[model samples]
Target: MNRFILLFALCFHPFALIAQQPVPVKPRILISTDIGGTDPDDNQSMAHLLMYNDKFNIEGLVSSPSYGSGTKGEILRMIDLYEQDLPKLKAHRNGFLSPAYLRSVTKQGRRGNAPYRGYSKATEGSDWIIKCAKKKSDQPLWVLGWGGLEDIAQALHDAPEIQSKLRVYWIGGPNKKWGANSYAYIAENFPGLWFIEVNSSYYGFFSNNNILDSVKTTDYYDKYIQGAGYLGKDFKSYYNGEVKMGDTPSLLYMMDGNPENPARESWGGSFEHLSRSPHVVFNSATRITDTVAFCTVVEFNLKGPEIVIPQDSVCFWMETPYKNAVQKWPGYYLGKGRYGLKYVPKQAEIVSYRFRSSIPNVDFGEGKLTVTNHWPGKVNNTDYKLGANWYSDKADPALYEGKIQGGKTLSKWRQSVLTDWAARWGWLKK
Candidate 1:
């Protein structure tokens, strides 16, 4: 009787397991990074991404540039990197920035859109963005933009079908001026879409110099160089010359807009009612079509429809805790702060990102993921290999130590410390 029952249970067990299986996995992201738009913050952001790629399935990388005359210059800079070993490490090619962009950047002056050099075609950011957003999975594809929103705005304008499948985290603009550049484009292209903005003035302080006083310039030099002592060598070689990285924290904020840190606020106005968000129609008032959301920043003093906060005061959600926000923007933050003003929207995802370090990872089929703990996922290895030949054990000790200990000159100590850390973590061979 026992053997018969066991055989019967075994036969049905397979059927039960099949019925209760998890859903199929979906392709995750296509990250757009503006490699050399303005500052070194972008570089730090890139490093952070590399460190955490194991957590997120970074589908592709599309390099974008700023608006106006600087656009091609930025694209050219990316092309230069693309022509090298940089893009391969991230497993992607240049997206959106085209050959015409390269010509303008390089000043080669070939008129008309020529085929992008060294490749059959340059993948457009707009196209990739639209495709990713329309994915059938329940999980929405995240679009992180560190540069201007031209490509994404264009994509949305072209593909309205993707609206519900994607969310945009744009790190641009100052407070009280959200959608100031392309309000019409945004309103028309992405109505009811999730938009998070990371403002500038507030992020500049922590991301550039004071990471809650934990990460400093010294640590950067040390961690980046891998102990070969390239302070006076390669790094210092460009110090006063001309080398910068873009701001990562700024990008981060944009990707996960906390209601507390809004790019657009009603500076110095009281909440009589939420103000009417304007919709500019075809650069004319008569062509207007939509009247979208214009929410309130409660506890903020408003004066005649304007919102205001102290220049130094931090804005965060009061009701929805910051911890809750972080959970939404997983695998994309450096760290969290204890003190700051908070904000909450009763009906929004309200996510925040921590640097890639926070999430545990496993391999997904196409890429790795650091998913919510409640879900099922996979991980992948994202370790970086730094060459030790760049260092010589015999460098000027005083200069190296000075740089490491926060003194006047660059040295090898910084490289040593970072290399040691990387080695310890199996990112590089010791």
Candidate 2:
């Protein structure tokens, strides 16, 4: 009778674990990374992905770095390591995608951040993203953004139709610091896209409260990762083997639960649906009286007397007070008797700025921006506030050692997640 009951329960479900919602057998994913850039954390994340690649139907690996000299060659370097470890990885799981295919799909995106307009010309990486997203499939193409949103912006600019077909999960904090222009473009233009902007929640992955000593960043690599395989050795080489895989949270979000439902508790941390982001436009220079939420993406649309210029790229530029010196941001010329410039304030203070144009007669003169606190908790937060359909950490997140805002959501699950990865790491242990 007990055996019959056990069999009956097995009949009820094939896999012991089930997701929050019905998901694809293997979620289709494409990764856009700054693997070779200033942050070595991405390299650690890439290593982790190749080690557990069986769970995903990996599509494209594009190098879309806004800062530093990240290139497709860096991705190829990791694939080279994966090639060596492929045999071992396949021993544990069947249907592991070939390294050759990963190489084929890998491509280079825009070398730098987009101009103030947000998008520039198309690259191999951006074109590949459009191609993959447009493929006829029941599941949406999940685009994991480990760095800048430049290629994603360029891809969307080139093909707006793909917006409906793509699901974006961007590791926001530091990456957003560098790719503000591209991020602003997407938030303002693509309001209905399925996007999860993990601005601060991702901070939970490397941080936690009351976690096992074995799972801490300082001990985890030595305990589970260092001697595992080729990927482990490569992971240890970065950040002195301390786990700072900030990009991996996006990968975990897809693997741990029903990614379609962002509010559900998962290893990647739960997020809230953000319907509206602060997007304000001004015809003239703004003043301290014209206040907006901190981290707001402000646009200045100027209509000057008609003037001709040889090139649009270098037509106009704005000078703003940043830190101790003045930093210049380029402005774009929008047709139909208009020019435009976008700015995202990072702190709660009155910012002053001036605009100059190559046309000589066209000038915005000067302006002041009043950035106010509206985070509901902390202040001067990341500038990753996105538009409608975008999911992010709650304003008041569970605090983990003085940090909060979507952080503890994942930290609470750190022990469980690390335990699972520990088992996987054992698979590579001969």
Candidate 3:
């Protein structure tokens, strides 16, 4: 009876024994970037990716330039830097991919933005995306669009069957503007596809709002990255030695949480679902504006010989002129009675402004209020703010109004990312 029972249990519970063996969990990833393009932030992000390569199974690195241009040579140059630092990185952690392996996977995608219909003819990079998606794997292939989505669009167009195997996280804002046609094609046609359009959350990586003063300027570079290794050297050379890895958050999202479930909170920040197909909210603060639409706030401390009367109440006036109209923007007291004001330009053309004080005792500082001839792409029209829920429909709508859900705040999310980055660079203990 005992022998018969043992045989029955063995036959019926075969998976029980197999499940006892620990299975390694590494999410498969493919980075499609425009590294050698106009913005050098992509290059900075790539350096951070290579430094922490052991976290994910990186399959491909393709150049998909949107606004400016990109090439395989630029990708190779960074890989060469990685090769030099491979030994040092290996000393800290295992599983760093070899330089030759990364080189083999590097390929070129579309050079410019896609047309109105989204895709052009097939390119080497687009073909590679399809091939990689079809590979037999339990894991889904995560296609990170750090640049334009043209190649991914082309890949899906050429091979629609592989749609089920793909999970895309596109760094959208201005990149979306560049690939508007292609983005429309993908969202409109592939409704079942899992896509996360990150426009503003990625900005948290470099935004001055969340970062500590020490980490923002020169302290972070001097401590962990500047002279650390080959990767550090290359990182220091880019963007005049600023730690602006805008694309790193996409990969960071995959590193901590269950890659199969994007809704779960992770180091990369959380996201909500879209109400409709992902579209750019023009003239809205829902997404971070490009550099063109930035508001510059300058503060002046009334002191020294410039102060004519200490008892006189001073009120600064800020005048912003839009097309055919000029409005006086509100100025608030920034604690300790400091004068400051913020204004987002409405038009794309040059906006002129004038600053004066009601009290004659107050001075207008060094330069007169002069707005340069620059275009502000999309200005904020509504008070709709950007958050983790910007790209996700799974989250509650109330969170979009700047309410905290699951105890998550933008500042907390930013800290989580910085902490992870520090750990990867051996700045913090594992």
Cα RMSD of predicted structure 1: 22.9
TM-scores of all candidate predictions against the true structure: 0.40, 0.79, 0.65
Supply candidate 3's per-residue lDDT for 226. 56
Residue range 90-196, candidate 3, lDDT tens digits: 77788889899999999999998765456778999999999899999988898988998899999999999998898888877557655655776676567667777
The TM-score between candidate 1 and the true structure equals 0.40
Ranked by lDDT, the better of candidates 1 and 2 is: 2
Best by lDDT: 2
Regions more than 4 Å wrong, model 3: 1-24, 211-214, 278-410, 423-430
Ranking the candidates on lDDT from highest down gives 2, 3, 1
lDDT-best of 2 and 3 = 2
The TM-score ranking, best first, is 2, 3, 1
Candidate 1 residue lDDT tens string, 1-430: 5998668655643221222112134225455555543344454455434433433545445655432122334434434433342333334322323324333313211111111010112236666676667756767776666654555665666676776676555554311122132333453334466654332222222222322222344444444333322121233332321223323332222222232223222110001111122221111111112121111111112111112433322222112135434322111111132121111122113222222221133111111111121100121121111121111111123322221111111111222222322432232212
- What TM-score would candidate 2 get against the native? 0.79
lDDT of all predictions, in order shown? Answer: 0.33, 0.79, 0.62
Count: clashes, candidate 2:
0
